[model samples]
Target: MFEKIEMMRMARALGHHASQRQIAVARNIANADTPGFKAEDVASFTDSYRAASEPLRTTDPRHLAAPDWSPADRRTLAETGVSPNGNSVSLEEEMLKGAEVKRSHDLSLGIYSSALDLMRTSIGRRA
Candidate 1:
């Protein structure tokens, strides 16, 4: 239920999420050969949606903290540079992530087009 709703919300952005994800993946791949380059991953907007969807149960008035400090704060990229090289980005991982992002993006566009086509047909019938 949540995944579908999140995907629908993403639909409104017209593939923005997928595009940004692709860009991030590409950046990671590009920096793969560079030294001290940490791979950056795209955060799923669905996480925020899920957090907002969950019912908040506060036992006390001060139970709820600031929204910014919420545990649901999405962290996409992993922290690197604990070592000297600081090169955490891996080409293989970046490529795989990129492929997945591309597939999802294509699927999203297909769904969007189909929905638009259905709307067109409905209007045409009315006419």
Candidate 2:
């Protein structure tokens, strides 16, 4: 029932995306000094949502269907300049990305809270 709500789905997706991004950022920060390590990040939430929400298409009967897309499945190579030692992670950039993830997660939580409040009010419960 509640799972069918588009708003709920979107909020869940946003939370998942934020969590994945935070993990990626943390990994990048941890590997900042590792030689030959490339920075990795997930695609933007909008892009990931669009991709994940897209209907799967089958071009041929013999062709295997594409796996459903999700926030965790959208890893991308970040283009942070490589250092002389071939490490691509940058502390400043990772910190900024972490902040962005925090903000996005907070926004998702706010939306979820508002939805719950609306539901409670509709049911005559104190919101």
Candidate 3:
């Protein structure tokens, strides 16, 4: 029943997006010293949400529907600059991204908690 709620869906999506970003940042940091390693990042949450929310269309009834997107499916980010070693991961930039992910994840959790409180109050339960 709770799964049908739009707020819950959004909260879940936000959480997933943050988690994906964290993983990407970590991977970038881990490969900072590797030669020829390019940094990758997931699409913006807004883009992912818009794509996922689009109505599904199938030209052939026998064809299976497209699967939902997960955070692990990352796209290569355009390089701002590359070191002489051909590595694009910047430790400072990755650290900033990590901090942003942490903030976003916290916000998502806050929203989820608020939604639960609202529901409980609406149902005449103590928040």
Q: Pick the candidate with the highest lDDT.
A: 2
The candidate 1 region of ten consecutive residues with least summed lDDT is: 66-75
Q: Which ten residues in a row have the lowest lDDT in candidate 2?
A: 65-74
The positional error of residue 15 in candidate 1, measured at the CA in angstroms, is 0.9
Overall lDDT per candidate, in order of appearance = 0.63, 0.88, 0.85
TM-score of each: 0.62, 0.88, 0.89
* Better candidate by TM-score, 2 or 3: 3
The CA lDDT at 96 in model 1 is 77
List candidate 3 segments past 4 Å from native.
60-69, 72-74
**Candidate 2: lDDT of 10?**
86
What is residue 25's positional error in candidate 1, in angstroms? 1.0
Residue by residue across 21-115, what tens digits does model 1's lDDT show?
A: 77777787777767777777756646654565567677888785534213232437755442357778867667777788778788778877666
Q: Tell me the spans in candidate 1 whose CA falls farther than 4 Å from its real position.
A: 1-9, 48-75, 79-84, 125-127
The lDDT ranking, best first, is: 2, 3, 1
| lDDT tens digits, residue span 1-127, model 2 | 7767778778888998899999999999999989999999999998888977887877888988654447755799998899999999989999999999999999999998998898889999998
**Residues 37-68, model 3: lDDT tens digits:** 99988788888888887868999999887655
